[model samples]
Target: MNLLRTLAAISSMTMVSRITGLLRDTLFARAFGASPYTDAFYIAFRLPNLLRRLFGEGAFSQAFVPILAEYKNQKGEEATRSLVDHVATTLVWATVVVSVLGIVAAPLILMGIASGLDGDGFDKGVVMTRLMFPYIACMSFVVLAGAVLNTWREFKIPAFTPVLWNLSSIFFSLFLVQYFEVPIYSMAVAVMVGGVAQVAIQIPALKRIGMLPRLSFNPLSGLKDPGVRRILKKMGPAVFAVSAAQISLLINTNYASNMGGGAVSVLQYADRLMEFPTGILGVALGTILLPSLSKANADGDIGEYSALLDWGLRLTFLLALPAAVGLAALSTPLIAALFNYGEFNAANVAAATAPLMSYAAGLLGIILVKILAPAFYARQDIRTPVRIAIGVLIATQAMNLVFVQMLGMGVAGLALSIGLGACLNALFLYTGLRRRSIYTPHAGWLGFFLKVVVAVVLMGLAAWFSQAQLDWAGLRSHPVLRIVALLAIIALSAIVYFAVLFALGFRPRDFMRRAK
Candidate 1:
């Protein structure tokens, strides 16, 4: 398989989903505004989403894929299919139990997670949480299905499946909100609808690939396989390791809940902006590289493993640097164009810009974790990453205490701490890889790093200069003008960024194919 081609396909589809997500956020900002209702909805949606990352995307897939790949490679089709059927059967039962319990425990969970919220915010969040809890069950099946397809190299449909989540949320936020007296309930229902839609869309893909598990009530079927035990063992540590980002989010949410009034929403908007490039670069690379790296590890080919990691790292650096720089520089305009309408005003945009820049400052670090953590995971070394995650979490809380509570930095403080922590997480992983000799540079990394830095510098200069050309008045005064200006700035920065890299002896073709 062409690794670059695979990355491109996944990233492109993910990009579409992220775009729709942005539109959904825009509508959310316009409809819900920065109120207790908005905060409640975010809190409601986030709890299940956190576990989604933990169980679905973060832990389950990481453990399942490496083992699944090993099974397919070492065993025959019968063995591989049997493992899938049993695991699928087991996961379905577990998901149902978790969803029912989560729904029943909604109010208690709300109090536990978002304790600062009180009265209406607290009550409303409990209602919304129950409405959205079943989504966890739906998406659990969705991601398990997705992991199966992804392991089989059926990347597109699974990657594009997230479009359902965004589309349903947007439809509800835009159209259905008006019908509901309390708009957030509609949004919660949309979450459930979208989850079902996402799972439904991917069902046929599994059949097409002949990998779909025939769901059965044989709860103990998975216990018959040693691979299931191996996956569960890995999952224990992998959950915390892969969920470092979401942990940071929960921490931030706890603090932001105390801050009162729109702080959470502002931070979220900034995160949404940061996620655009991340979806394209970090997510794209990480998802594609894991299976490849696992195969390489299974073959005991250290050279191929290192080479795949190297390729992913360089590509991440190439993309993440300019994105980080561009986002930090252009935060104001981007926020203004997409979100500075309806209830989102100048003050909201200004508030969001700080966190946006703060988050952008750590974009490379945040994305690097995505890039590097998989190397540990593919090799089934989950404990090292878990240790790193623990250290980073402590560092994050200390910084949060200083930045948010002591220094009074407010929402931006949470953003800054997250960025700094991400840097530490990536650094720890890099050093660990070196010490273990799990990954070594293929050659030309310093040159590649320097070249990307130079390009990003030029790009940043161009972005800074271009922003000077547009005042706050012209950028935000009219919707059409704001859209045009933001696009122009983005295009100009991208051109300069790529042009500089191209002129400095960097070729796009080189990145598309790994160094031989």
Candidate 2:
């Protein structure tokens, strides 16, 4: 398979998901704005959302996919099918128990995560947490299904499934707000409905591959399977690695909650804008790389393994640098164009811009971590990342203390700390790879870096000038004009970036590679 084509396909699907997600966030901003109540909903949603990443996508996928690929590579189809059945059964049992515990302990969970909430805000958070807790089970199933599909090289379904969730939320936020006394509760309900939709679509896709997992009647049935045992053992470290990041986020949320009423919401809004590039590049590349890396490792082809890592890193720098430049240069206009409707006002746009700019600073590093982490995971070595993650977690908090407390940067400081931590995490992971001689940088990197830096500088200047021509705040009354102007600026900036790359002797064929 052509890796570039596969990455493009997955990225196209993910682009659709991100667009719909932006629409959903825009609706929320317009409907509820940034307030203590919206803060309650965002914070409450963060728990199940956190679990969705922690268990479903992050650790579980990291542990599960490489092993699944190994089984496919070494074992026969029947053995692979059996492994799937057992793993699915185990995941179902574990998620069910976790969901129950989360529902029952919702109040305590909210208290621990966002202790600054008080009275009705805290009460609403608890209730919303309980209502959305079971969404984890649904997403766990969805991710398990996705892992199977991805291992089979069926990337479209997994990449596109997120759009269902986004659409579900958009529909609810648009039409169902009036049904509830507290409209924000509708978002919680939407989360559950979206989860179900995501899981439902995975069924036919799994059936097409004839890898549909026949779950066992008894939850303990998969415990004796050696493959399941190995995956579980690997998961021990994977969970810790993922949790380290999540814990930092939780701490940030707690800090934001204590800062003021709309602090969490402001951060959430900035995060939503950041997700556009991250989902398209970071997630898309990571999803495509891991299984291929696993195959190369399984075949014991050191050259192929190193080549794959080099290709991913080069693509990351080529694309991510431009995206980060665009985000930083056009932060205010981007925020104003997408939001600044209904309940989202000039103040909200202004509040979100700094954090967005801060996030943009580390955008390339964040995407690099997505590329770099999978190198370790594909080798079935989760321990190194866990160790690095633990250190980064501690360092992130230290930076948080300095940026948020000592410097008094508020929410923007919280974002900056996370950004810097990601850069540090990526650096450590790269050094580990090099120290072990696992990945040797291919020739021409210096020239490539210089070209990209030059291109990004040109693109950033064009974007800055175009964005400055418009008063984004004043254009709030003309939403169409504002959105059109923003899109035009983005398009022009992208043109300039690619044109410069072309003039610098870069070509699409130069980066293309096939993975077997």
Candidate 3:
């Protein structure tokens, strides 16, 4: 597959999801404000999200995709289909049990993570927790279906399915807020609805691809499948590897819960802002790279594997660097434009901007982790990344403690600490890859790095100048102008970044255009 082409499809679709997500969050902020109620909902929502990341996106996708690819390549269609059936059967049973147990234990889980929530906040969280529990179970099938589609190189539908998620959430959160006594409860309904839609939207695509598994209830059926066994074996360490960042977020949220009103919401808003470019570039690239890398490794073509890694890294830095710079420079305006409305006012915007900038600082680092960790997983070297991730997690939490507890830096501190820790994690992963000679710097890297950095500097200067010129505070009440101004600035900076790079001879065709 054409990496850039596939990436563009995923990125564009993710961009839609991100845009709709902004609308959802904007509505959320207006409806709930930066209060304990919002915090309670976020914590409640996070319980299933934490598991979704662990089992669905993070560990399961990482562990599942490569194995699926291998089965498709090594075994015939019938065998791979059987393997899929077995895996699907296993996940269906497992997700059901976990969701049931989680629903029953909602209060205990809420208490364990959210000790700082008062009685009402705790009760709200418990309720939403139970409501959102089914989402994880639904998404487990969604993840498995997505992996099968991806293995068949059916990337577009899987990518587009998130649009359903965002749209479902956006519609319910915006329209249904009035009906609920606690408005955020409507959002919990949206979460489950979106989960169902996410799975539903992919079914036709899976059918078209002819890779959809027939549902089987025999859990022990997969127990004897070697592919399933390998997946289960890898999933243990992969969980730790993938769960590390989620673990950090869980810790940060726990810490923020004690920091008084709106603290967690501030962090979530900043994170949402950061995720825009991240989902587009880092996630898009990793999603494109992994299957190809796995195929290369399975074919025992180390050169192709190395080359693909090199391409992914170069593409990552080129995009991630300027994205980080532009985002950090325009952090305040962007936050103001997207979220400063109704109950989410200037104070909330100000509260979120610092952390957004902090998050932007680690943009490249976070993307690097996305790209580099898959390098290990595609090769079935899961333990190394897990160790690296655990160390990074500890360091991040340590920094969080010092910044939030010792220095009392609050949200920005936590954000900065995580950003810095991401850099460290990326560095260690890159260094490990190089030391092992798994990935060597391709020729012209120095020139590529210099040119990209120079372009980023130019983009950064333009963004800073534009931010200084805009009167965001005055424009806040004029929502239309405020949004227009923010978009104008974003357009100008993006133009500058790309135009400068193009002027300096950077071409998309270089890394992406495959040898025909």
Candidate 4:
């Protein structure tokens, strides 16, 4: 498979979803603004989303895909299909049980997670959480189907499925806000709708591939399958590793909740913005590279596997480094331009900017980790990453306590702690890869990375100057003008970065050729 082509396709789809998500968030900020209600909604939303990442998307896919791929390779199609059916059935039942418990214990969970939210905020958060908890079950199934499709080399549907989620959220935030009476609660409804849509979108593709898994209560069928058992066993440790990072996020939210109304919302908005690029580049790379790496490892093609790993790392750094710099440089202007409307006030803008900058600083590390973790998982080495992730989580929490409580940095502190932990995690993963002889940096990687850094520095300076010029020209006074100015700056930075990279021996054609 052409890694670059796969990344391109995934990136294009993700860009659409990211833009739609931005529109949804914009509508959210306009309607709800940075208030206790908004904060409560964010807190309620975070729990399910965090779980989705940790369990449904992260650990489940990491552990399940390699084993699934191995089954497809070693056993016949019938055997692989049987394993899918059993695993899907079992996972759905498990998620349903867990979702029910979560709904019933919503209040207790909210209170534990955000003990500082007082009065109406706390009450509303619990209500909203209960309403949205079913999303965990819906998305868990969707993710399972997605993993199956991805392992089958049918990437487009799963990659495009997220558009449904973003569109549903945007529609609710826009059209349903007035009808629902309780506007914030409508967003929760949108989430459940989105989850259903996400699952629905994948069914036809599963049918087209003739791999639509039938739901059954017969757990014994796939339970005895070696691949299924192997995936399940590795899944335990993978969950622990991924949960470490997610737990840090929960801890950060707990601290943010105590900072009064809108803190959680502010942090969430900043995170969404940061996620735009990461999802487009980091996730696209990881998703595409995983099956490729798994296939190579399965065939004992270590050389090809190592080459893909190197390419994945370079692509991540090349794409994410400039994004981090550009975002950090233009955080406030971008936030103000996109969100300074309706109920979203200047204070909200101010609050969101600092944390966005902090997140931007760690953007490369975060994306690198995302790209590298699949390498370990592809080789079925889950426990090492899990152990490292646990260590990182502990360090992150310790830093969060010092920064949030002792240093009094609030959301920015939380962002800093996460960024710091990501840096540590990425370094550890790279070191482990080196020790295992799974990956070694190509001879040109250092020079290429240095060139990227130089290009990013140039881009950052250009963006900063462009922002200053726009400000001096009073462009920011008008929303349209501010948006236009922001776009112009972004365009200029991208051009400069690409041009400089090309001139510095970075070959676009070579990258594109590799994709072919």
Rate residue 68 of model 2 by lDDT. Answer: 94
Quote each prediction's TM-score.
0.97, 0.99, 0.98, 0.97
lDDT of 2 by residue, 1-516 (tens): 999999999999999999999999999899988999999998998988888888888899999999999999999799999999999999988998999999999999999999899889999999999999999899999999999999989999999999998999999988888999988899999999999999899999999999988999899999889999999998878876755656787789999999888899989888888878988999999998999999999999999999999999999999998998898899999888887899899998999999999899878878888889999999999999999999999999999999999999999999888888888889999999999999999999999999999999999999999999889999988999989899999999999999999999999999999997
Candidate 1 lDDT over residue span 19-85, tens digit each: 9999999998887777777888888888899988898989998889889989988997888888888
* Candidate 4, 63-136: lDDT as tens digits: 98888888888887998888888788777877888788989999999988997788988888988998888888
lDDT assessment of candidate 3: 0.86
| lDDT, candidate 2, at 49 | 85
Predictions in order: lDDT: 0.87, 0.91, 0.86, 0.85
Task: Kindly indicate the candidate among 2 and 4 with the higher TM-score.
Answer: 2
How does candidate 4 score on lDDT?
Answer: 0.85
- The prediction achieving the highest TM-score against the true structure is 2
lDDT for position 458 in model 2: 95
Whole-model lDDT for model 1 versus the true structure? 0.87
Q: What's the CA error at residue 121 for candidate 2, in Å?
A: 1.1
- Report the backbone clash tally of model 4: 0
> Ranking by TM-score, best first?
2, 3, 1, 4
Q: Can you tell me which runs of candidate 3 are displaced by over 4 Å?
A: none
Error of 2 at 431 (Å): 0.4
